[model samples]
Target: MFRNFGKRTEKAPDADTVVPLWPQNGSAAEAEPSAEDRKLSAFLELKSRMHEALIERLNLAVIDKVEPEELRREVASLVGDVLAEENNPLRADEFRRLVDELIDEVLGLGPLEPLLADPGVNDILVNGHKTVFVERAGVLEQTGVRFRDEKHLLRIIDKVVSRVGRRVDESNPWVDARLEDGSRVNAIIRPCAIDGPSLSIRKFSRDPLTLEKLVAGYALNAQAAAFLQALVEARMNILISGGTGSGKTTMLNAISASIDPRSRIVTIEDAAELQLQQAHVVRLETRPPNPAGGGAVSQRDLVRNALRMRPDRIIVGEVRGAESFDMLQAMNTGHDGSMTTVHANSARDALGRIEQMVSMIGMELPLPAIRAQIASGLQIIVQLARLADGQRRVVSISELTGLEGDVITMQDIFIFRRLGKAADGSIAGEFIPTGIRPQCTALLEAAGARFDRAMFLPEEA
Candidate 1:
């Protein structure tokens, strides 16, 4: 279940009004003005006037060329001088705050800078310009942030997409991009988005969570962590299966950290997000097609090219298309420790998804043969799930024990058994071993990785 990281208390702003900006250390009366207060209206009007003047005085071309700190200083001085000439009613600190926000509107992601700065916030969702929601500790809450209008939201969206060398016009009204800090961003506008411009941002933490942190957070038991580390060290192919926001990529990153530093690893993704610390890692990202509908570099192409690069391991961020076939081939052909994530409800469904993906390539391979390739290439599947209470945990760890007749056989080595919900609505569960030792334990032993057999023994056993 979700751990309470202490709720962040913020006053929700009015949708129709622009909230007056004040310094953090300003007087409580000035900082927390009520909506009905005449002073609040005056402050907002002054901000609007000052903002326009600052924009006009600013050199847009030079702003992009100068350092951010330098630009901030220059803009601050300009705003201060303009406020003096206009006989601004606000205090010096209030003027400074207004200047900083105006600079953000010009040089940064307008209303999103504050949300992005909040370490507690994990996601920022903008439903047009008038509404914004954020995910904090797996719970969605409406934030007081908003753009001026739909046009303001569209401008921000264009700024994000264009920075990534992508476009989103009437013809292509949807785009996926990454922020400078690796946050995943998706935006849709106009024709596709009937409800004005919509933007969703999945924020990545500056400090990535490690396996130890995950175990401490009860995302998985210590035994399962040790088992995964052993699997990586023994060069076993692994498939991580989870639904959206189930912590699949986080788990993949944590597990991949166990990989040997000397081995060269290649990672492919639509948008590069993995933070693998291995020195020999090669990162590749897919590119969207140009306006001419050409020059697109797909994940499948990257996977194929990774093979010729002589990688010891291949890690695809997620297999969503025909790339599954190429990734499987890489895993089968000597890339023993390769790993990938899949969007699936369970381990069995993950395999089924892979079969469907491979078939999409038009290979016309028999179902049995496809199952065989999957069973042989993948040694384990670690399934993750975000519970009703917003806690992400490893739901199952299944071993791919090869094909039995026409179907692939999998045995669960570890599983999270849900007991019930606690008084706080958090899901209560215990992770326990199934007592059946994985067939790959022999392979792990043969590869010089020692694991305790007692780890496989169930509590009753």
Candidate 2:
């Protein structure tokens, strides 16, 4: 129902106006519009009129319960009328790349829409008209695509959020939405966001995380990786922790990759981010409230349900709220090797974070009680970080050796000892085995397995 207003700057236009069309040139005088401007104007006008017409026709057809004609013809007719192109052959020739923009809008996804379709792009962020960023190869990079202007950007934002059955406007200027592809989308308009409409899409990988890729990325050296593989194979409840964008999920995926293929795995997440390889993985995602504001499923609910599913293991993408309590309970109960990730700066901080988050679940339990559960439920905490040199490394791998009063005791099994710096000012470090045997591995040995001890051996190995 809205026209292309373009990406907005500080202020939204007054209520009554359709967003101004994208500037043809750097100017918006709307004169003998520049050729590019002319096409955009024509495109927008055609789409607007056709969308109205299609809706009206559909409403009428609904009353009669009659089927509409083929989508191509319907759109072509509308496009021709809008262009008066049957009589303007010149315009028709120029329009061969005919944009059934409206038809695409009304019937299905539109052009330049396939980016949303591809599951790999993992993230789509729009910085303004000229800069688009996507997450590929686990890194964010700028892509070439711009809205005609802020007005055009805002229009696209509105179209996207509206289709998701969510609202974004002056009163509710920010929106959290999910694309049909299950990509999490968030958008903020002008007053709140300094530039134009700002959008962030947290995209999910179609083929999830695998140990093979983790090994290729140097996330863990072969021996360490093999050890984790065996640990998962043994069903040890593990917790991966780190700050934002530190490859926490990636590490969790690698560790979870160790789960036996035949064991039933229940994975839960607020945004469904984990990509597990187990054939028996049952992935569950939480839902936001609907337009009427009902029917919401949270991570805690899924965790509670997973227990009844008789899961051999339960993995939560991350413990963000009260779900932490349920996750801890699940882990302490019967789910050995149950795993999840949390946001914290260090391994010790991860335990505290869990204590705080579990409290968020509204248990109001004593801090020590929470620490006790975490210590017992989570046998290990693997911390990851993206260092200043733009390299993500395993900062520390620590073990939870039970609790002491209100404090959680942890031992750093593998630490990134800052050996020094490279010639280029880049920080150099290696994942050094603390030389203390990991407590969790005793369980492994008892399971009739052996640790990859030689891999941890130094040059002598």
C-alpha displacement of 87 in model 2, angstroms?
A: 6.0
Query: What is candidate 2's lDDT per residue for 1-461, written digit by digit as tens?
Result: 34435756577667786665664564555455678767766655555555566666554344233334555565566566755733544365445445444544554434335566666576678886556887765567776544546776776777777775667776668877666555567889968777778888776556665667766766666666766776776777778888877878768876776677888989887665566777898988777666566788888888889889999888898888888899888888888878888899988788777777777866578877777777778887788887776567887777778766777788876677777889987777666666777766767777865566555555412
C-alpha lDDT values of all predictions: 0.87, 0.71
- Model 1 agreement with the true structure over 1-461: per-residue lDDT tens digits: 22222233275544564443433455666766577555545655665676688778888877789988888788878877886787755677887778777878887897799999999999999998878999988899997676766877898899998888999999888988989888899999999888899999999889988889998999988888889999999999999999999998889989988889999999998988888989998999999989899999999999999999989999999999999999988888888999999999999899899999999999699998898889889999999999988899999999988777989999999999999999988999899899999988888998987578788988632
C-alpha lDDT of residue 410 in model 2: 84
Best by TM-score: 1
Error of 2 at 84 (Å): 6.4
The lDDT, on a scale of 0 to 1, for candidate 1 is 0.87
> What number of clashing residue pairs does each candidate have, in the order they appear?
0, 11
